[model samples]
Target chain A: MTYCVGIEVDEGLVFAADTRTNASLDDVRVYRKLHVFEYPGQAVFAVMSAGNLATTQLALARIQRDVDDAAPRNLRTFRHLFEVAEYIGQVLVSSQVDTAGRPEFEGISTQATLILGGQVAGERPGMYMVYPLGNAIASSPETPYLQVGESKYGKPILDRIIRADTRLEDAARTALVSLDSTIRSNLSVGMPIDLALIRRDDLRITERMRLDADTPLYSDIHANWSRKLTEAVHTLPRFPWELPQD
Target chain B: MTYCVGIEVDEGLVFAADTRTNASLDDVRVYRKLHVFEYPGQAVFAVMSAGNLATTQLALARIQRDVDDAAPRNLRTFRHLFEVAEYIGQVLVSSQVDTAGRPEFEGISTQATLILGGQVAGERPGMYMVYPLGNAIASSPETPYLQVGESKYGKPILDRIIRADTRLEDAARTALVSLDSTIRSNLSVGMPIDLALIRRDDLRITERMRLDADTPLYSDIHANWSRKLTEAVHTLPRFPWELPQD
Candidate 1:
């Protein structure tokens, strides 16, 4: 299980993902789920994956190889964000197909879902969720976010806080908060979170870093959010039958 | 789909359930998921059901019939709250068996899960979640709440706020907030929630009420919670890279 989220606001795009992966409880491993492909001031793409680790790694390796070969259909050659998303979806499907062909892989799923967020030189910054079925859906102004994997626990905060006009930094913070909510409620999602922010029209990654459980900034956000939530709960209106406080 | 939660705290027990039931989107209906069995001044039990509607109705109908007949294994004859939970689980299993025996129901499931919370005369107040397999688990001091059906969206708050020493009214309000979160995040769980409160050693329900989306009290809680949450988000510490505000 994993929790990854991407938010597209007026200022730019924000992406965050947890780094824990496990075949089973005892087989837990920490793997980087956020991958960034940057062409300096020309174009930059951040891809965060969830689901089958082998399939994701295969697709990512192929993507890196394509970029290395300067392939015609590679991420660098894409003119629009959606085209890049479509190529990622195709790569995901092909990777799954290749893995599933082995007789030993019977009854195993090789599906991987990904969030692709970036800007091409000539296009506006955009975000999309690439599905395992070789299809993708773009985020909209009304719903300025895309999430893949263990999404529900973290969604309420996103639904309440995010907007198209939200600042990039605020969106990043909100994404972290959303990821924190998911990590707290679910054991499968753990820390050493990767976060990336892209300012609109910058055509380059603005801020990209990994936050572990003990990272001061992440720890401060977690502690403060928890405290504020508890304080907020205490401020809820009293039930009608309760005696007024003295 | 349904959402029901039961919380056991020092003051007593809090129970809540959403009323929406549907076979599909077009087949939606409102049905009470919370039921009470009370022998005034002697004992009271609140049972919240989720899953197969027919199985739940049959189990509940049989429980009523058993009480009517004063059967040896009926809820009325139970000495401990766990015994009543066991009786309910057996009734549920029997109901599923009876329904599944028909040829027309061959491939269908008639399973129902329930939360039973109340106090029997000599024991402390208790809450048990009866599984479809006819086994039940009670709430413990460390985890004072149990939830069933479409439960994830509402769980984070419960994890952060609920404790063994929480006040009964606060617990009830927390349950309502939890239900509200689920309703917002899921279309399957919806309006007109049923709530019941039991005070320890009272041997009777202290409060039982239905809260629809429009109920002023429920509406106020919803509005206030949303506002407080947004305000809380604003209070979260800013990321170090963020520019200082004027």
Candidate 2:
């Protein structure tokens, strides 16, 4: 199980993901689910994935190979963010289909969910949720946020907090808080998060870093949020009790 | 879908459940999920259900019929909350198996999960999460909270706040807040909630009532909690950034 979120806000786009993968409880591994394809000031695209690590790795590898070959359909020359998302989704679907030809793929849900968001020089910053089936949907005013993987636990916070006009930084913070809520309650999602921020029309990564247990900002946020939540609960008026006989 | 929570706290026990049921989105109904079996000053027991409504209703019917029979394993005679939970679970399992024999039971999971918690004289305030198999586990100091039916969305708050020594009123408030969070996110879980509070040693209900959409307290708590959450998020320090030139 995994939890990844990508938000396209007025100021920029924010992407965050947890880095824990497990085939079973005893078989756990850490994988950086966020992959960035940066070309200095020209373009900066971040792809975060959840589900079927092998399939995701294969899809990424194939996309990377396509870019390395300087193919016309590669991420480098994609004129729009939608094209980039479509190309990535197409590659992932083809890869899964190719793998399905082998007997080993039987009974496996050879599927991966990817969040593709970034800016190309000519296009505005955009975000999309790319499905494993060679299709994708871009974020819009009505739905400025998108999440994949173990999403339900963390969804309420996003629904309550995220808005179309939300500032880039606040949206990023909301994403982190949402992820924190998920990781605390779910054992499958763990630490060492990868977070990326891209300002609209900047065509560059504003902030991109891997946050682990020792990450100062994350630690501060987690501690303060918990304290505030506790305080908030306590400050709520107690039930109107009709005094019982002592 | 439903969201119900049972907490074993220092003040006593708190049980709350949402009242929404649907065969499908278009076929929806409101049915009370919280059932109480009380013997006035002798004992007060409350059961909350989550899972197939038919199975739950069948189980409840059987339990009530058993008590109505000439030879009854009356909850009034139960020496402990554990026994009360066990009796309920057995009845649930048998009732489910019996109903599965009917045509309407087809394709149903027939799995019902129950949270039974309250005080019965001579025992500590106890709580149990009963599975469909007639086996159950009692809540402990380490796990003072139990939830069933669409539980994940509301769980993070509980995980962070609940402890064995938590005051009953605070726990009740927390449970209500949790339910509010879930209700906002899930279409299948809705209003007219059933909330019950049991006091330690008194073997009687302190407060138990149905909360509808018009209930002032419930409405106020929901509005205030939402506003407080938004305020809390705004209060958090934003990500400090030296703006990068475009």
Candidate 3:
């Protein structure tokens, strides 16, 4: 299981993903779920995935192969962000189709879902959730973010904090908080978190970091959010029965 | 869809449920989902449900009818809280089987899941989640709460705030926060919450409320929580890059 989110605010875009991958309860390992494809000042795309790891790795390799082979249609040649999402979707579906045809593998789900966020030289910064069926939906002003896998536990905070005009850094912080909430509630989504930021119009990933369980920054954010949330609950108005009679 | 939660703390239990019911996005209505069976000083039980409303209504009516007709095994005759839960699970399962056997209802689901929290005079106060399969599980010290229907969005707060030692009113407040989060995130769950409290050994509901959108206490709790959550986020430590460089 994995939890990855992409936010497209007016000022920039933020992407975060968990690193834990488990084939079974006893077979847990750390694997990078965030795939970065960058051309520095020209364009940058961050792909975060959840589902069958083999399918995602195959899809990622296909993407890199296409770029290395300089295929007619590859990430580098795409003029828009959605085009990149479409190409990745096709790759992801094709990768799953490989194992899906075998009768022995019938019970396993070789599906993968992805969040693609980036900006091209001329296109605006945006986010898209590419479904396992090779379809995609872009984030709009009203819904400025997209999430995949183990998403619900972390969604309330995003619904409360994220807006189109939210500060780029603040959106990054919110994404971290969202991930933290999910990690604490679910064992499948664990640390070292992959975080990336893209300042609108920069056409590049301005900064990136990996936050582990002991990362001071991530630890502080986690602890502070917990304390503050408890404090917030404590400050809510008391029930009528709890109040002293006038 | 609905959102109902039953929490058990050292002091007592808290039950809260949303009133919204939707057949479709357009065919939405408000219906009570919390049912209380109190024998005052003898025993008390709160049954909250989510799923096919017909199934729940049928199961609820059966309980009352059994009491009215003096059935051999009725809620009033139960010796322990688990016995009551087991009885409810059977009733709920039987209600679903009614439509399950009909060919015309094959495409629709008549299943219901329930949270039963109460106490028999001689038994310890406890809570149980009765499954559609006619099985039930009791809340333990590690997990002092049970939630049914649209539960994920509201779970983070419960995990953060509730414990075996948490104050009863604080647990009630946490339940409200959980419901508020679910209501905001899901259109299927909505307003006019039904809240009830059962103090340990009290053998009756100490306080009950139906909080509509305009209810002052509910409104205040909602508004203040939002404000305090925003403030809490603002005070979190800034990103290293967000700080001033020396």
Candidates' DockQ values? 0.59, 0.60, 0.61
lDDT of 1 by residue, A37-138 (tens): 999878999999999999999999999999999998897787888889889988989898545567887878878899999999988999999998989999
> Could you tell which candidate, 1 or 2, scores higher by lDDT?
1
In candidate 2, what are the lDDT values of residues B81-108, reduced to their tens digit?
Answer: 7788888888878766545567787776
Error of 1 at A108 (Å): 1.0
Chain B TM-score for each model?
Answer: 0.94, 0.89, 0.94
lDDT score of model 3?
Answer: 0.89
lDDT of 3 at B55: 90
Q: Please report, in order, the local distance difference test score of every candidate based on alpha carbons.
A: 0.88, 0.83, 0.89
Q: Poorest 10 consecutive residues of model 3 chain A by lDDT?
A: A222-231
Among all windows of ten consecutive residues in candidate 1 chain A, which has the lowest summed lDDT?
Answer: A97-106
In model 2, the runs with Cα more than 4 Å from the true position are: A98-104, A237-246, B68-72, B98-106, B237-246
Could you arrange the candidates by lDDT from highest to lowest?
3, 1, 2
Q: For residues B1-246, could you state the per-residue lDDT of candidate 3 as single tens digits? A: 899999999999999999999999999999999999999888999999999999999999999999999999998998988889989998988898556567888878888999999999998899999999989999999999999999899998888778788889888888988998999999999998999999999999989999887888788866667567666777777777888999
Tell me which residue pairs clash in candidate 1.
none
**What would the per-residue lDDT of candidate 3 be over residues A1-246, giving only the tens digit for each residue?**
899999989999999999999988889999999988889777899999999998889999999999999999998898888888889889988888656568998879988998999999988888899999999999999899999999999998888878787888888888988898899888999989999999988887888999887787788886666667777777777889889999
lDDT of 1 at B47: 95
Report how far residue A227 has shifted in candidate 3, in Å: 2.5
Residue range B91-137, candidate 1, lDDT tens digits: 98988865557888886777889999999898899999999989999
